[model samples]
Target: MTEAPGQITAETPPRLVVLISGRGSNLGALIEACEQGQIPARIVGVVSNRPDAGGLGFAEQHGIPSQVLNHRDYPTREAFDADLATAIEGYAPDWVILAGFMRILTPGFVDRFTGRMLNIHPSLLPKYRGLDTHARALADGETEHGASVHFVTPELDGGPVIMQARVPIVSDDTADTLAARVQRAEHRLYPEVVRRVCSGEIQWSGRILQADGTPLGAPLQLDEDTHNASPPQPAG
Candidate 1:
């Protein structure tokens, strides 16, 4: 199988097509990162399933191409995904990023960009896989909870993790408070993972994740402390 478009050489920055459904603070972060030359990639376009998504406005303000294909207008999930894929492929992105894209894509749609797409979830994988993650974490009396960035797979939140950001669940933290902290961490974590992916330092080999050609066996962790530290040395 051919490598995903995410696999990039050192010479050119990766091209990105970011998808969003809401306000898209993460999308804003990406746009800032690209502008500041922090992440070695370019967001060529932003697509939203909601016509009124705020991110589209952010994209326009920054002069990035934006599009809306309301999922509600489509007859079925597969049809929506087909058109969505076509719209995204038009940009010829090296990666398709789901930055708070709330839709659950069809299997065929996911397969079309299997190894090239990515998503960031509000909770650690194998844990609060769906919504209300902050509430769930608080209710569970979890001492620590955070966000995860992973490859997009047909199984919801089941793809091999690329990186994670962990934060302490304080004694009196409510869902909103906890979510705020996690979002800050996410703004840091997601770009770093993208940097690694763009630098050819880490990659998905269809089934497993590898750093420098060696299997990771599990996703790399990026806690609050290490979030600012140098990137982890690849395991031998």
Candidate 2:
């Protein structure tokens, strides 16, 4: 069962299971953070949907156990998810981190973990919920674009956002350029959020909150240039 908000701490550091697709930069960030004692947790396992994902090599290099559950091999989404859940459960993880997992999980799979899972998206949430977020923002000529970390709900990227790091859209920025900058922000932003969650500084009790047991009025913020996180802001 998912632990209640504030249940995780340094005494009982969360056993983190990270899911990744593609490059898995966020996974690498988490790994570094764990090794450096930045987060009160250890990554127990890493899962990837594609066997060739570069993240798999990272996992192996770190001596962390990893599995690849090719979604195409499964007959249905639910079947794939059921097996995925089993693979994750084997590690007895206290938290599931979707570093770059690309699949749209089934509701059953999503609900299984409930409050114990998190994901980082490319764009600040409630604005860009789906793919190509950088391109979309550029198309709209938005002045600001960034990344967000949110609880994993079945509604794709429509989950409750917990934190964000905003970077200004430069006049000459291409989608690739913007993505590169945002990813750097993510390396900073994702690890810090995980540190907070594992340290019991942030938790989800129906809604996200601080260790003081107050609601997080607004998503946590990070400085664009320094990537330094600001204190928790009041909810509007």
Candidate 3:
């Protein structure tokens, strides 16, 4: 099993290596959190599978090191993962964060980070595990939908969820509308989860997840009103 990131302290914040494939809105949130001292962590670098990912520019603007290892250049997933892992390990990251990173990682890559990796899924998870979550949720007439932040495991999005924020499904809500709300929730939820992880308030021992040393059989749900506020802060 991979070791957890070193406990964060005021003098030594946790180091994060974020991976992105697109706009990286979640990445933006994390950057803001670190800058504002909301989380005791530093985003050491940002890596993207696409050379033209917009997140790379955002990283550069903030003076954060950024790298691109285009997936198309590699012949196989394992090959790409090998190179990717090498690039990430070079930074000596305390945590590997997938913020909209659009690649299905190989087991080798997943195992390298194991307990020290995290991802934000746009859905409530264990519901629409794959994609098109907004459309699916709306079509099913679900009354509630939102986002989840979970540990990264080899079973795709099957990892245990740490925290979730729910949005009420309104009448005549389209996929696009619902997705916008969910994205807003994600920006708030993901950073709080990262904060908790870095503070050692939440952790995974083997496959079980715990918060404040108490086992959490299910993901902790956040009150949408309070948790979805601007510039998320640590939950008490």
Instruction: Provide the TM-score for each candidate, comma-separated.
Output: 0.93, 0.94, 0.93
* Tens-digit per-residue lDDT, 27-136, candidate 3: 99999998998888999999999988999888998999989999999999999999999999988889999999999999888988899999999888898998899999
Candidate 1: tens digits of C-alpha lDDT, residues 80-199 = 999999999898888889999999999999999888898999998879998999999999999999999999899999888888888899999999999999999999988878777776
Per-candidate local distance difference test:
0.86, 0.87, 0.87
Runs off by more than 4 Å, candidate 2? 1-11, 207-211, 225-227
- The collision pairs in model 1 are none
| Best-matching candidate per lDDT | 3
lDDT ranking, high to low: 3, 2, 1
Off by over 4 Å in 1: 1-11, 226-236
Note the clash tally of each candidate.
0, 1, 0
Question: Could you tell me the C-alpha RMSD of candidate 1 in Å?
Answer: 2.6
Q: Give the clash total for candidate 3.
A: 0
| lDDT (Cα) of model 3 | 0.87
